[model samples]
Target: MTQHLANFKARPVACVTGATRGIGRDIALHLAAQGYDIAFGFRDEIHASNLQEELVALGAKVFCQPLNLFDAKSINSFFDSLNTAQFGLDLLVNNAGITKDNLLAMMSQEELEQVIHVNLIAPILCAQAALKIMLPQKQGCIINMSSISATKPNPGQTNYAASKAGIEGFTRALAVEVARKNIRVNCIAPGIIETDMVSDLLKGNEQQAKSKLLSKRLGKPRDISALVAYLASQQAEFISGEVFNVNGGMLLR
Candidate 1:
């Protein structure tokens, strides 16, 4: 029965950062249905425990590790644990990130650094760790969760935009370098998704935001999850170094 839902019975092992909530949680669940054993990183212990329970119910071999992406020591320790476990990681989803919104003029240096460290540097570090294992096997897929804000600037999101834009640059360069090793790198830039993180923004202004979308509605978590699942699958073998926009046609380019 589960085999029908998941096309692959072999079941790839995937690691997803920020899998406790929002888009990351959805991605983890969706991949589990597609027969992936999941190793996830989370900031909050309570949330991580809850997510592990849910994934376990779905019969997924889930590993929920507490990770602070902003801290280099934490990042190194988490990867070291994975290595000691002898888990051959196949798909790496760099979904852990944060936003410190403020106008460029008013944004503090600390705020800027915090956003950059989580959104940009963290992904780079996670990818580097994944590459250490993947390069040897000559196979892997990496999906970095980016934002449409990377291209379409938001008034108070200068720091966020810059960090996301940096992911695009990282994706392209890393894809080229690792193509020979059979490792594929790509990005997903979502716009106005209906997640817990952004529910406040959409609560009373759903109509106004919908007006800006060609689809006439905010994107759902499942919308992005489906794409992530496809990209992680063998169906996307030829695709690499591309930023897929799941934005309800918000940016037409």
Candidate 2:
């Protein structure tokens, strides 16, 4: 049984974390247009408002909430709010993450802990909460955002890469657990996408980055969002427990 707003026609619901910018924002927009009422979490108030307005304009019911990835209460409270609204969430996109890059020897304890907590632990917690909703419904999809760094690790990104690697592992294990329940779990590992998160590195090394990619250009947010939409759809019902790389062939398996 799909979830619906109390007074409106049934619309599949999606809850996305870190939807204020970059790939997260693009996914929210794309899903809203795809006929899913979107309930999103964001750290930035202004950007969240803009996203809410846009989603409404797209003719979708929008639930925008503040999220502090660092705080467990905030994460659970957000899901609680979603459940209270009766959105009947059909998808959860764990797209929020941060990078604190430094050589392991040079990285501070705070940097290491915060990076792992925000990038890895937060998504797991979000999924745990979402399952409370999904399992009972007998239908749902979870799409986690990992990075190519997980496999093709660079020197200073030990923490970032490790966190993403953990996410990939979590996806596989969780997928197996819930596959029998008709709930799918999958992860997407993106290449160097053109987003604010990687702006500084992409700026000076544009040519260097392009040379390595078979696509010869940096990825746009839409590249990742497009795949996210596909994985959330019925066509991908057979796909789960897999990590899809959207890295422009940056590191081929």
Candidate 3:
């Protein structure tokens, strides 16, 4: 069950996956601050518990549980757990992803499948479930997280690139199908952000990372989270089926 404010019963609700840390964690906090009740999936209770406390402090109702993105049933169960009648599902953010970097010649079959399943398939299933709830309400927004790698491939990230590319395509096509229902789908392509997921690439070399971007600075989690907040708000009602690149002008071509 979720802990909530007394008057939270009427607030908008959003479900964000892979929210235990990094971009996902910040997005959840940002949404809560913006007055949206929050729901998220996690693999670690410690992280989930900490996040729950943070959300509650922001006057938000939180629905969170352990989630295994590789399993379809698990994904469905996460969405099912939300109380659609009481709070309403207004936004879905598919921000969970993984990267197993290795040269294609040395990459394992298992590696490819794991990355693809979590990064790509998981979001498709999430959208499928969220759409079921949104279509009926005739008002919802789905924001899929993609990466610059989807367009500008990096060495030893073939699987990661493929998965993210699929997400971009998925957002566009799905947005068209649900546009008439007033449900908008959009994708975000973040350049290299300073998060644990990509800390290895950053590796205490802020100057080096900044050198590669036109902004001459590494992107922060809040950079992406800010756009997410806008995209989920009424101000972005007219925006959909598009991808916003938040990589400080990183070269994608």
Candidate 4:
């Protein structure tokens, strides 16, 4: 048992939210391949279970739990359970986010608050929870997912943009607060990725969107996942409090 505990402590762990699909799923898989045990939370139990099996098959110990981003109680319970797990957390990837796009004039209060709760509030809470464990260990890495919309807003995306912009600001501020403790915080702003979440946005304007990208193609989850892996690695130890863009050159700012 002592040897087993030592082995468990030797392997790094990563907790990824909304990790059953899209960019979140890719990040979890990429990290598992890099030898990190995975702990993931998702709203869909069946999907999360299947993903757990897949990750386990990849030779990484996997943990899956239910998460309701709308519920603060649920978020707290998740981190509490994670802190008790055998694998110690060394990285956190806040990949879960939602967008309710509508012109401000037509947007209902419910829509605005829901988007803000999931995109901005929940991530902030998760980061706080992770810091509880990370600070004691004197090391950890946090990667928050932002979007191109955060900087370049399109019509009918005011709430979405605002929430993401908050993510960038929070990431920067938190990085400073935790840098002295050996914790690195960073943000990623992805451009038009070909995920189901954005399928509608690309429906009739696929060609038009492609034209705007210097790469002339939509970004893939792998593109973002690769960068995430780099940031979580020791090579990026000097990098923190910065936002990296994987937008296929769609925006130059």
Please identify model 4 stretches exceeding 4 Å from their true place: 1-8
- Tens-place lDDT digits, model 1, residues 47-78: 87777777778878866566788788888777
**TM agreement with the true structure for every prediction:** 0.94, 0.95, 0.94, 0.95
Tens digit of per-residue lDDT, candidate 3, span 1-253: 3333233457898889988899999999999999898988888888888999999899888777778999999888877766444456899999999999999999999999999999999999999988778888889999999999998878999999999999999999999999999999999999989887678676778787788888887899999999999998889999999999888888732
What candidate 3 gets wrong by more than 4 Å, as runs, is 1-8, 83-86
Q: Per-residue lDDT for 10-50 in model 4, tens only?
A: 57988899899999999999998999888887777777777
Residue-level lDDT of model 2, residues 38-71, one tens digit each, is 8887767778878888888898887766779899
Q: Give the TM-score of candidate 3.
A: 0.94
Better of 1 and 2 by TM-score: 2
Candidate 1 accuracy as TM-score: 0.94
Q: Whole-model Cα lDDT per candidate?
A: 0.85, 0.88, 0.88, 0.87
Better candidate number, 3 or 4, judged by lDDT = 3
Q: Model 4, 194: alpha-carbon shift in Å?
A: 1.0
Kindly give the number of clashing pairs for every candidate.
Answer: 0, 0, 0, 0
